[model samples]
Target: MNIQITPLTEDTIPGFHHVLEEIVREQKYLPITEAPPLDTLRTQLLEQLRHHLQHFVAMVDGVVVGWIDIKPKLSLPYRHVGTLGMGVLPAWRNQGLGQALVQLALKAAAELGLNRIELQVFEDNAPAIAFYQKLGFEIEGKFRRHARVGEQYRDALGMARLLEIAH
Candidate 1:
């Protein structure tokens, strides 16, 4: 399967909405709500794209199968840091699409002058944690009882990847 990464554009909004909704629906361990209406999602996505973030779509066979977005933290102290988020369709997972999306995000972050990238994953999502770790992310912290999934409280693991570490 040939996978291609392209910059997200207004024309691809519908495809993005479809892929996002499908991914959210198939997520078993993570808490993901149904995506907003298409119009709302389009507006929100355009607004975000206009900001300091970059969004990319992963396409296979002319269909959008995944997406990744990264934005630099705006706080003065965190100006060099970027946060990344990604989602892949259920049928597209385990085919290295997730890793490809993340690598694209990292490249965008580096181009934007970000020295670090961070993300939060639920502790129970072992596969995600392993994926991030395989990409050189290190667990930096944890939030106990951070989110409620159903009746149980779940912990969140904070992970970060430093683009350049001073020796």
Candidate 2:
């Protein structure tokens, strides 16, 4: 399969949304069970682009299969920090697409002067936790019963990596 990783663009938004909806429907990876309305998502994506956030999508034969995005923390004191989010279609997992997507986001984060990157994962998701650990992220803390899906409450682990940014 010919895989292409590129910055998220208007043209790729629909594919990106489709991939997200698929993942969300699984109800095992992300906290949300459904994607936001398409128009709402479009507005949010445009705002992220306006802010120059580091966001990327993985495409196979012109179809988006995964995405990664790192948005800067809002407070002035946390300006050098970014929070990351990502997902890959089940069929595309374990094929290095996730690693490639994250590496690109991290490089862009460093280029933008971000000194730290953070992410939160459901504590029950061992594979995802291991993936982040392999990428140099450390388990910083855990939030008990952090997310409630229907009648179930899940714990979440906060992970972070400090980047050595060169002046």
Candidate 3:
């Protein structure tokens, strides 16, 4: 299989949305209603791609299979830090796409001068936690009962990777 990672563009918004929706639905996660409309997302992505963040879409055989996003911390003291988020379509999971997306995001963060990268994974998501661990991220902290998934509160584990350290 040929997997290609490319910077996201306005024309790729629909493809991005398709992969995002598939992942969310497969994971039983809520749709991103709080995000702006599709046009807004496209514009925001373009702006971020140009300035503050890096968004990459993974394509296989000309179809979007996953996406990854990395953004610098918004707060003043944490400006050197970046956060990452990613998802792969269910049909594409366990095929190394997630790992590739994360590595790409980390590389982009380093190129953007970020020293630290962090992410939050639900405590129950063992596979994700393991994946992050394998990529040199350490569990730095946890928020007990912090996230409400559906009607129940769930703990979230904070993971971090210091770019200064060799993987």
Against the true structure, what is each candidate's TM-score?
A: 0.90, 0.98, 0.88
Give the per-residue lDDT digits (tens) of candidate 3, residues 92-133.
889888888888888888887888998888888898899999
For candidate 1, write residues 60-115 as lDDT tens digits. Answer: 88789888888888889988998888888878889888898898788888888888
Report how far residue 78 has shifted in candidate 2, in Å. Answer: 0.4
Candidate 2 ranges with C-alpha deviation above 4 Å:
none
Question: Per model, how many backbone clashes are there?
Answer: 0, 0, 0
Q: In model 3, which regions exceed 4 Å deviation?
A: 27-36, 165-167
Instruction: By lDDT, rank the candidates, best first.
Output: 2, 1, 3
lDDT of each: 0.85, 0.93, 0.81
The digit string of per-residue lDDT tens for model 2 on 64-153 reads 999999999878999999999999999999989999998999999999999899999999999999999999999999999989887899
The alpha-carbon deviation from the true structure for residue 106 of candidate 2, after best TM-score superposition, in angstroms, is: 0.4
Which structure is stronger by TM-score: 1 or 2? 2
Highest-scoring model, TM-score:
2
On lDDT, the stronger of 2 and 3 is 2
User: Poorest 10 consecutive residues of model 3 by lDDT?
Assistant: 27-36
Error at 46, model 3, angstroms: 2.3
